[model samples]
Target: MLIKFDVTNEEGDRLKMQYGQKVASKAFKMAALDAFDLYHKNQELHEVIDSQRTEIRRLRNIIEQARSSAAQLLEKTGQGDLIDG
Candidate 1:
């Protein structure tokens, strides 16, 4: 997700006063780079999660098919009541 987060003026002033201009600018640069890296990582994690969900749905479908086939087989073999009981 593309987030719209901002560092306010008060925060900027605090950083400047506490760390001086050079260090403060470097810190801001690092923060921006870190945020960029995190955004890409977050996107990758989401993609993985989506793929896993798709896989789970596929597996569920297979399981349902197997159960249906098993019931059919039992019915053909005169064992339908065996499963119901």
Candidate 2:
């Protein structure tokens, strides 16, 4: 996920004074780069999570189908009451 970092003019001036111009600028650059890296990592993690969810859903569907087939077979053999369906 993308994150926004904004600083107003007064904030910028304060930061510049607290830390010299070079240090302040370097800090800002590093922070921005770190944010970008975090966003990229977050995106990759989300993709993996989504893929896992899809796989889980697919597996659930297969399980439901198997249960349904089993129930049908049991019914044909006059053992339908054996299932808790």
Per-candidate TM-score against the hidden true structure? 0.63, 0.60
Candidate 1's C-alpha runs over 4 A off are: 1-30
Candidate 1 structure quality by residue, lDDT tens digits, 4-85: 4377877766766654555556556556767888899999999999999999999999999999999999999999999979
lDDT of each: 0.80, 0.78
As a whole number from 0 to 100, the lDDT of residue 20 in candidate 2 is 60
**Weakest lDDT window of 10 consecutive positions for candidate 1:** 18-27
TM-score of 2: 0.60
Across 10-44, the per-residue lDDT of candidate 2 in tens digits comes to 77666667546645565565556678888999999
After the best TM-score superposition of candidate 1, give how far the Cα of residue 80 lies from its true spot, in angstroms. 0.9
lDDT of prediction 1: 0.80
Cα error, candidate 1, residue 22 (Å) = 16
- Clash total of candidate 1: 0
Instruction: Give each model's clash number.
Output: 0, 0
